[model samples]
Target: MALYRIADINVEYEPRFDMLRERSKKYLIGPSDKVNFKISIKNDDPSKPGDNNSGLSDAECEYIAVGSSFYKGLISFNGLLLHASAVAYENEAYLFSAPCGTGKSTHTSIWQKHFGKDKAVIINDDKPAIRLVNGIPYVYGTPFSGQFDISENISVKLKAITFLHRSDINTIKPMDGSKAIYSFLNQTIKPSEPELKLKAYKTLDTILNSVPVFEMGCNMDEEAAEVAYKAMKEGICNED
Candidate 1:
């Protein structure tokens, strides 16, 4: 096993993942700023003793899946098992954390197409990292990209966490912190252990203290990002 760092957090990778090492890389996910994941399992060897194999004992396989999901890059910072689209730009990440067919990926695509080459990076169209450090919320890129390209784990002071909604025009509205916390919590992919719940609450507190959460309703356009950026800037001002 070898350990790698995502932000300030350390993750342990199974030596078995070594076979896919060339295809593997670390990434950050959600607002929690969790560890990188071991993506794309090319081997399902049941007799294997290592973490990357699906052939291990049930308990071992489950444990490896859990650990690797966070450490290998299958999980995101918000704690959700994400299939939604995501990307990062100008040190900030914009995520569409909704269920399938909610236009999350489409929203991300609009940004990429309009934002121009090299101006933006998609941590993962499917998974990104979110974390709060000392009550300052932020997002980071990861390797589990969905529709777009994946970039290195780059942290940005968060502007906002806006849920996606279809609409006639672009608009960003403040979401109740408590409600936002609850919704975001529901998205996480983890065991409902007591300690995990406690940690979740603590993480939510950190996020509330750092960033302004919102409900974004809009057509696929650049205005949404602009509105989000302005709102985040305003929040930053208030904090200052």
Candidate 2:
């Protein structure tokens, strides 16, 4: 097993499965650490990549891609995943999730720009880990980064989770815990097994009880960041 380290967390990719080298190299966000993770990538359709040696069945490859992180215990899918961006600042973590192309990155960038880039960093732009510690929800950074080359092993106690939507101006509204659970589940990519679903529900319940959930609607501008930050401070500071 080859090892890679980032932000002090160790990752290990077992046995050096050479067959997956090309795809793994292309998608690798960081180096392997002590934690064992197996990642596999396959063409969406066999005809697309057009390679004879890519013998993986579509389903198996898909499972490896989505389920590998949890298998290694690097992240807890809880049968849910989110297409979101997260960042940490002032001892707090914020998550902005939405369907693809709905500005998760842009929203994160706005905050980084406002807070000074060095002081703000994205935890995960594609898939971040959500788990509970001592009954408090927290978000962790995973190597499964997306368009943003901003993955490092990092975690923060979750301050809030805000589902993103477009608006003419900035607005932040409190989310009902029950409704928040559904939105949170919808953001997850896949949850094939029943155990994962049960785990996810438990995680969501922990989150609802521990942190504030909100709906964040804003224009595609920096003002959106300001609005969210201020609202989060008001909403979660006391809870913390």
Candidate 3:
């Protein structure tokens, strides 16, 4: 068994694959007598079959399994996984969320280019954790950060969440409360258990009430980043 800290939570789990161990090396810590949770995956877990069907090796399968378990466990601590690209700029985090192939990472890369590398850092390219701490929503990086494995073990105060869509011209607008909730829910994991699902909903409610939500239609251009940053950060909608 190994101990690692993620999103300010100490977790103890035995990684049976080298890839998982390597991917999680940065989060490792000295043996701890106390842990927030522990995860143990048996060889015959149901995930193996689904992963195999998806053409992933045993090693890759284990990585997915571990991530799923961790995110599910995070719900108890007022945290849940958000399928988004999280970037930190000037000590604040901005999350761009969307369905797969929607260019979430591409949009954030534009931000890096527009703001300069020194100002923008991709904390988690995928699957970042959002937790409510003392009534503040924060985004955290985890090891299971998509195919590229681009992530840092850091947490930043969340400023806003923007849902992305493809468009010929860059435009953004504030999302309505009902629309925001639906868009946000589609991007996060929904636990199957009754109690955990309720907790997840409550946590999401706190986040929605505390953070701003926007819908941005953008193309892959530096101007896209500029438009989004201006509207989200300064509340200046150029198109309006």
Best by TM-score: 3
Off by over 4 Å in 1: 15-20, 26-86, 146-149, 234-240
For model 1, residues 95-176, the per-residue Cα lDDT tens digits are 6677657787777667777776577566566655666655666665544344334546667656657677788877767777
Residue 198 in model 2: lDDT: 64
* Residue 81 lDDT (model 2): 46
* Candidate scoring better on TM-score of 1 and 3: 3
> Taking the tens digit of each residue's C-alpha lDDT, what string does model 2 give over 92-176?
8888988888888889989998898787788877777776665666777654566445655676878888888888877788877
Model 3, 77-175: lDDT tens per residue? 999889999999989999999999999999999989999988999999999999999979999999889898889999999999999999999999998
Off by more than 4 A, model 2: 3-80, 236-240
Candidate 3 backbone collisions, by pair: none
Compute each candidate's TM-score over C-alphas. Answer: 0.67, 0.72, 0.96
TM-score for predicted model 2 compared with the true structure: 0.72
Error of 1 at 36 (Å): 12
As a whole number from 0 to 100, the lDDT of residue 20 in candidate 2 is 33
Most lDDT-accurate candidate: 3
lDDT of 1 at 142: 44
* Candidate 1 vs. true structure, TM-score: 0.67
> Considering TM-score, which of the candidate structures 1 and 2 is the better prediction for this target?
2
